[model samples]
Target: MTQIVQSLAEISKPYDALFCDLWGCLHNGVAPFPEAVAALQAFRASGGKVVLLTNAPRPAKFVIESLERMGCPKDAYDLVVSSGDAAQDAMFAGAVGRKVWHLGPSKDDGFFTEIPAEWQGQADIERVDFDDAEGIVCTGPFDEINEVPEDYRAKFLLAKMRDLPMLCANPDVVVDMGDKRIYCAGALAVLYEDMGGEAMYFGKPHPPIYDMARRKLAAIGGVEDGRILAIGDGINTDVPGAAGEGIDCLFVTGGLAHDQFGADQKNPDPELVRAWLGARQTDPRYTIGTLR
Candidate 1:
């Protein structure tokens, strides 16, 4: 684990591009971190490309809209690649001509609006036969999955036994929803996989989203992969995902873990950060009090 001073001015050697995580590193889902926003703007003014890589379940447009609402200026980022966008890509890549059973909130339907006209809506899999259907797409409600009854689980398992592949739109197991740790698509996917189902993920900690972000960065004349930097707060998603892609990561404290472990108890302890990363075997390139 490395400890770097939290001074944006010290970043003299401007990176070619920056891949920043959305939730905890940039904002706490409610407001944009003023420092983070300023830093991004500074980096861009210095000719650095900024690409925001988010694990948000919504598509790029929705994510951008949300950022705008949260006070992050449009100029703060060059491109936004969301898990929701990756999910849409995965849906079309494998199941173009077939029908899909979408299991998610109503708002998530917008994600599939771009899909082929023939590949939409839910249907009985057993009656239609396995070869005819495309696959199961899930963009689960952060609040609903945990409350599901055992019967729903049994039914979903039966669907899996029929050899239907499941494409998980959001790979986050859970996210902070107004002080609650709600279930996410990845958690349900894990359960499905445990029941002998084949699940494909399309979000953070997964490679496709990172690949897309990299491509977008390259298009904007951003730095090559070696000079790119990833800033995130979640160890399970952002940190590991960036590290897996061989990009440098700057971990922000005071997100989910800070709340779970009591923020006031330990705010600026390098040893504590090291222990947290060490437990997960994810040593980030830098650790900071906050991304801002």
Candidate 2:
């Protein structure tokens, strides 16, 4: 059984660092949650380091910019590690070949242009037409607000026939953008796999992102795995990622699964939370209605 808590400070003493998710845990894609920001700031003030472990399909630099734009104070987190950076490493390493079809919006152009300084001078990655491509690199649906995964079934079937592997950048199936819910790259990837197309992931609940998170943490000041707590609203991505890495998890229930937990965002029904977890077969060490 998972312990239900009201705030992060209740369990902060035992942890040295936090692998915090950004989407529903911190901001809702439109603005910052004041309480979540303050909680992270307080944790850092108490000598805890915070790594913004995100599944955003853009590079860490772009993620930082997004945070800055959203007024997420810089003092809250020490580092930002994104699935884009990890996926870029694999894409550059020839995971999905050089010439691939790009399946995301214009915002994700940074994915192709923002090559790190170290990876400069590598073989060029080309974005070609779906019919002419060797593989697919999906950040998300071109229009997340209006498009569904089924919209691309025709293309995915063709890709399956050609046997072109897809490298998924963001593994989040859906995220709440303000009050509206939108599908992400993972939704499309799930659809692809359901249709017998190969879809590769480098985001949360996957080893690659965790490995990258560990490396990034080590570069600054490494925390023992036991002393690091994973914080997120994503049960599938955040909870399983922490469990697989043998670390504790703090599940923020007021995110995507908020409705199922209860009507109140701050006050969650414990029984409902447990039942939700049971349905998902996930067990987090702690649960909070929201980050604060």
Task: Please list the residue runs of candidate 2 whose C-alpha ends up more than 4 Å from where it truly belongs after superposition.
Answer: none
Worst 10-residue lDDT window, candidate 2 = 258-267
TM-score of each model, paired residue for residue: 0.85, 0.98
Candidate 2, residues 237-260, lDDT tens digits: the string is 999989999999999989988888
Q: How does each model score on lDDT?
A: 0.72, 0.94
- Model 1 C-alpha lDDT versus the unseen true structure: 0.72
Model 1: weakest 10-residue lDDT segment is 122-131
Global fold similarity of model 1 (TM-score)? 0.85
Off by over 4 Å in 1: 12-14, 95-97, 115-134, 142-152, 260-266
Question: Residue by residue across 162-266, what tens digits does model 1's lDDT show?
Answer: 777888888887666545566677777888888888888879899999887877677767467778888877778888888788988777776667643335522
In model 2, what lDDT does residue 158 have? Answer: 91
Assess the local accuracy of residue 50 in candidate 1 as a C-alpha lDDT between 0 and 100: 80
